[model samples]
Target: MKRIKNGIISLILILLIFVSGIPAYALEARPQITKPDLPFISAHRVIKAEPVYRVLADDKLHWYTTSADEFNYWTGLKGINNDGIAAYISPVPLPYTVPMWNMVKNNAEQYFVTSEESRDYVIGKYGYCDCGIMGYVVALNDAAHGNAQLYQWYRGATDYVYPALAELYGLDDNKWDADHYYNTVVASISSYKYEGPQFRVWSDASTLQEIDVLSPKGGETLTGGSKVNIRWKTMIPGGNISLYYTLNPSEGWSVIDEDLENTGSYEWTVPNSAASKAIVEARWSYEGIDANCYDQSDQYFSIKLGVGTPINWALAFKPLAMKALLAPAAPSNLTAISNLLQLKPMLYWQDNSTNETGFVIERKSTGSYEKLAQVAADQTKYTDSSAEAGMTYSYRVKAVNNQLSSGYSNEVSKPVFKKPEIVIPQSEPGKAGQVNMVFTLDQRDYSVNGVTKTMDVSPVSLEGRTMLPIRFAADPIGAETVWNGTDRKVTVKLDKTTIELWIGAGIALVNGVSTPIDSENPAVNPIIMNDRTMLPMRFVAENLGCTVEWLPASKQINVNYPH
Candidate 1:
């Protein structure tokens, strides 16, 4: 009886193993699995496969051995009906799919996957069992390989993957409760895409090297309607190039030409609109990517109105013709005068032409010409107060306009004159007021009280007495001297004193008292020379309350006036 019972236990264990190998639906009724109407899933029909496990709406997990037909039925039903029950293989792991579903539901309203083809491609590449985790892996691989098309497709599908899965699972929130899974997937893709240098080439046209504008740089004054050569340099060849202009750098870009080749230069006729602030932009493109290489002017330039004959608007299609303007004529009749009174040099010129902005006066020293001063257009004279006495200076003047300068005028040169030095001795107190007068020999130009006077006869020394014309010498000292032709005598009058003297006389009368002209030497007397009365300067000056001295080495005579 014991042997028979053991044989039955063994037989029962064999039957249990056989039942577990068969399809679960063949033995008992199974719960139906439903699908959700998500674009990522609906566009890509899940392939039928033998189910290895099952997930229920209530979070119940089950393992099953089912045929391909039963799995297909569940997959098709689950794709369209959100019954919250899914049957999938063990290859489609639940750990990743649950979290991915949660992410999609939270972000469904804000993000979307628009490309149906991309959804099918991703589903075909990575099985639809855990579609969310499959998409994440495909996106990372595409980004790492710099596959721009595939990367964009996967990025778009991200929005729909998790939310659609959450609907299929019949859960308001994600089963895995992952809050930032979507963002983490997106950030990882972006980081991996930018890791390689070639990523920019596939992703962004702006990241390509830019073209450089080589000519018509900022601040250039270009003539309107004139042909100008616009130049640029770029690494991208055999690409489409275009030119654009704007009055303001911020906006208003007008196309100059769009069918240009990237051959570095293009000839363009300037427009009629005169713009003081003009900017130009150059664009280069390869294939269909515009702005592949782009550059613009560093700053604003200027466009001036054209001159001369007007261009035909129909045939030429250019702005008004611009003629080059000439500068103002060179200033003429340039003259320099040495001012004896002010001890400076004055420069004068004639403005022979109009439209002159100013005149540039240059002075030539020993070697080179240096800019002296700038004067207004109407001004014709300049006073150089810094001129040094006894130095020669040459000067020239040029007329200037807004754009150019005329040739220099005829140069004029002159030497400045030096003035003589004078000295006066202080007088002592309690003594008769006396002054001394001295004059340099052969120096006819002299100034007294700021007025220049020329003497009829220069001063001379006669028998050791310095002599000068009585009228010329006495007038400066407030003494009046008169000549009598009939009497051949002269009279000198001062304050409370008078002097009378005849030509060729050794003696003279002072205050009606007869006294020798020179008490020390009788031979020294007053005479007439050069048709003027000559007198002993010392005697005459002393009689007029003055004193005198002679300097032989310098041929100068000293004069002192009493205080």
Candidate 2:
């Protein structure tokens, strides 16, 4: 209902005060000079407490200014015709939890408790309080919760919102009107918490100093195949800070390119691979002010690029120039081909800077640089044939012209690793010591499936195999194993936890605990030979949620994972 207490306090106060005392004060034997202090006292006494109008402060608090008021204090809490009800902000020197958990649960903060009727005015239909009664905003951590007054319930009068939440045990008044006092709190700690802190981004270096980046945390390094999160930490907590980024001297930086709100941090990435020089800049562009990350003085402020970044300078392009980069009849696609995997890095740019001589793709683990592939002088494309199966590799592509190179392209970091292989050994139908296993694997490398025990560990060489329990080879397949021999359960931690497979006797157990594996799980019945246990890979892979692709032409089995 758009609470107007804080919004219209001046109007209400003006209407209530009388001018009779003003004229008499000045004529008080010329003693009216004390008018400034006298009127202030009378004003505060009106509310039975000291009340000071917010004013401008030079420091961060912005102390008494309306800008501060609009942003912090809720209009719903301006002034309530001397309801004789008030709330104060004071630290209760006791168990922190005692006060925090209790008062907050009641939508109450610190020392003042709102009447049931008052509660309805805060959250119920058309309820708004005088700004003066409500304490100054302290802090807001989420769009749902922050120090800003903008996020204070939007003064909603929804029947469900105020009633259901207020109905929780402890309101004391069965007829309590949660709708009236929902906004009674300067800061309410509702159960539905805003998970991450509010992020602030700015282009001005000065403001940037005030912000803290939570993601891509300082001193934290991400090689290939890692998530790039950009978060902002600020003194003034609020909901949804927009993030911004850019590279290139000509195209000055901006606050946020993405439209998300109250995001303290965002997912940032540079071509999956590390780069020698790439700006992974972050800015909170949500509000009108870009709280941090702008260098107004400099035309182009390149973010401090770290070492070992795989960069392709030739393909870098500014967002506004995307249209121009595309209009020039140039194909922007890189086709990489690999037996097991193919990873292609994309690049872009707005205008033609110099002689586009393609780009250089570098790997950090080893400072080896490769001309992986290239595009036309005006073209923007690169193909990478080095994606190793089961192994992760990082990649980034930038554009380059004869004169100078553009800032490195945005990062495209992902790791490429080779998949592992598993095989089963076959034993001579009637022979105990004579067993053989030759695995035709799709991937090149893998690890032992589980901790030993299911299979006896003695292989003459990597060639011969015996009857070993599946548990011994479970790890490579990404399976978690727990068995005391009787109640055997294999857990594939990839997606879910299970306890329903008893090898000897088919059975299932609840998750988190152990159960028996089923006999049907194994293709072949246990044939004790060479003093080892052996089972089929198909059964294990399927139960573990792994994708098994069998190639009839080459008799190859590929076991992949979501597991």
Candidate 3:
């Protein structure tokens, strides 16, 4: 009777295999399956080195293990001795797994297929082979989740199992090939090699966590200086959040707010500058937590020229509106004065407009106004060092903002006169140690060691301070000047004192120490004009052991040596 019972059981098993259209030999070689010990049952399970099974779910392959000891070893979960358990596993590759899992999970729902159907398909085709079953699961999951690359990941294993299954099912080989499943599976496996001994273990399932921008997503035209509310969504509960923006992707990020609470929304005031392509970035982090996430706008948005418009404007009104809002008020009290100390004419104006971005100075020569110089809004004086001697000129001043110009101010006229030649007494033949020099304000000629030489570029007053040509002034005091063309710097050396100044730079080095040009004395900076290097007369002259005196009434600069 026992022999009969065993024979009946064998017959039932064969019938089951035959009904499922799978070969009996495929199940005969299957590995013995065993349940794991009890210790592995936990919210998060660990996996160690062991032969584990991969299961099919919704046509995707997932890690699963029946060994509790292996689970405890991998995930550090403590299991009681002899405690038997079974569970599905989540295999996450450390470090190499990109942080795009949140995106995958959010999109995975659309590709979800019946897990039962996928399991039945695997059992019907590949019988009970663990790897083959998992391969089918992975292929189905790939198809459902739109993960073409993942399908390619297990294509090799699937290809070996597919032909035999088709033969058992009695499906036409020509139709199967025509359907292109065989070709597709073959093609998918081409890019990848099957790396055996793949990791598998059971653990607590992880939830998808990500941040998404709800509003102002992209393609919106926003105005500068206008207030807007930025909205976002995240699975994380509460954490520190910050906002950032960038004009271009390659550039560094500019922080919009650093200490914002993760309240899902922020009120932001747009910047005043206009940009056609802009991106907004949001970052979130928690104290003492390992999970930190960030997101950026998927597409570029625009910051346009208007101050308070959300919609793109009509072409005709944009130009007019931009002009009206940005134009500064005209400057006033424009004056052109002849300086006897220098060959150039100095112009001064009253900055009458509070909103002026900058001042533009224009000179009229031959009845047409020519732009001479543009100065910062705070600057009220400019020297026309390029002006030729013995020429009459008319000057006007105007204010500007964002390339918009205001009406010209009252014009002022001045006549440039040729300076008189200065004569100096010759130095004593035996006196070699001491040098003496004198320069008068508005005078084109300076005396060196009691001898005078004509100067091509003269000393001039700038921002109420006198600037002199360094090459001429320092040479008279026995200081040597070296020009570094590569660095565009001028080095002056005189008796243990070394001064370094760069052209168009505001900082100077006095005896190897950095010193800024005095703000109150704007002329202290070294300037280059028409190939001549000029420096502040007081800074260079006083540092070299000379005393400077100003004759306010006569507008003369007097420098005495050995003081």
Candidate 4:
């Protein structure tokens, strides 16, 4: 009879809920929030010296005497999803800690203080009759104590979760009834603002790693040459800070003020140029850790020359047609094969222009010029099979695009040698201590002692000279290469000779004597391409007593050293 009566009571409760037209799922418990949405905790002050209390799973404000007890309550109650609470992972494991002082204005309002500047600002800005630090909460998080993060939330306030909750609760401008627990009465669902895990406190003292940007938060327009006060909240103390701004990331950052004292605010003069996209950044690096604690403007800002004035941009600056202003550069290092290995001699030249439609090849036999053939852009080698065997031919190439054409390259003359005069060197057997390396132009793969290897950057031709990366080209021949970044110079030591050349310098020092890197073309200098340093192969090989030969048929360079 007793069990039957208890079942009847439970059935009446369910019948009552259904009669009220309430959803069944509303009776379920709230789900757990495992991870925090924001990186760090945020601070909110409706008014100032009210002590912010940590609301535990019991739905009560608990202020512990010891930080260890506070941490114990936090970790113990963290897993319990009774209240909407979670922990955040800081970028740096051990963060700086400071004391949070509870300051009171009068017998009426209270203000909590973390920074001294903020403490003074409220005192001066707002009338505070009784201004004094009540007590300092330890905010240090280190290895000695168990690292625990402190979180803060506002009661009867809305910001992050305000919009969604306001609509659901039918809250107006002056109506906020949600408590710290934020639980529902009829339904089991609750909506509360997600104030980020505010303070990083693991030590006996209370402190935080939170730096908030205060002013120019986002979407603000200022006139050029106007003074604006940039403000931020600095939690970490005793370290220098740097301020920077940029139109865009691709344009790189420009320093506003570097290594300035952390004073929390700086007055800046807006730039004179007009820009639609501009951003500001505040970076702080503390001692004892390799971490950059920083923050950026929440949104991009705009800067105009004047307010409501339509300035003529055409009168301010002139524009030029890029294609018409610059023509394609002339091709260099023109070469034509002499030996009669095929039907016609082969012509090759280094392509010096990046923008070109095609190359126009001109041949002069006995008289003026005659059009030979036109090859596509980036083509370095061409076959002139139409040349008469007995007659000598002169070839020149010019790079041409739709809009402009480059000047003709250096003239190269090659006579079709008779078949009888052609000679091929006999293949000799390999020997120890003898090095033979072959590298093809515009190719990354090269062969050393019959073994193939790859290079980061390929060997290239510049100004009628074969250029190779000093390290790759010299290492195979038992040469030592060293780069001096300060002087922008490269040093190669082989046998008893030492060769040194500076980047963009025409002269190279050989055995304490200065000589032009390319005597034929004194303007030829070492250049950096694709982050690799390219040097004249012939100059280095000849100076090191190695035989250097260029084979046009395959566009290969052979460097041989005999021991």
Candidate achieving the largest lDDT:
4
For model 1, residues 339-394, the per-residue Cα lDDT tens digits are 32335877777565456789999986599999989989878889877778878899
Q: Write the per-residue lDDT of candidate 3 for residues 232-284, one digit (tens) a residue.
A: 77654566666776654433345577547789999988765576566776765
Higher-ranked by TM-score: 2 or 3: 3
**What TM-score goes with each of the models?**
0.24, 0.22, 0.25, 0.26
Ranking by TM-score: 4, 3, 1, 2
| Most TM-score-accurate candidate | 4
Task: Please say which candidate is ahead in lDDT: 2 or 3.
Answer: 3
The true-structure Cα RMSD of candidate 1 reads 44.9
Worst 10 residues of 2 by lDDT: 39-48
lDDT of 4 by residue, 249-320 (tens): 434455677567778999997766676666777765443221345677777778788544444332433322
Tell me the lDDT of model 2 at 175.
18
Q: Which residue runs does candidate 3 get wrong by more than 4 Å? A: 1-432, 519-523
Error of 4 at 427 (Å): 19
Score each candidate by Cα lDDT: 0.52, 0.32, 0.52, 0.59
Q: Lowest lDDT 10-mer window, candidate 4?
A: 42-51
For model 4, the local distance difference test gives: 0.59
Q: Please give the TM-score that candidate 4 achieves against the real structure.
A: 0.26
Tens-digit lDDT track of model 2 for 248-289: 324433333443564465665443333322233333322222
| Model 4, runs deviating above 4 Å | 1-429
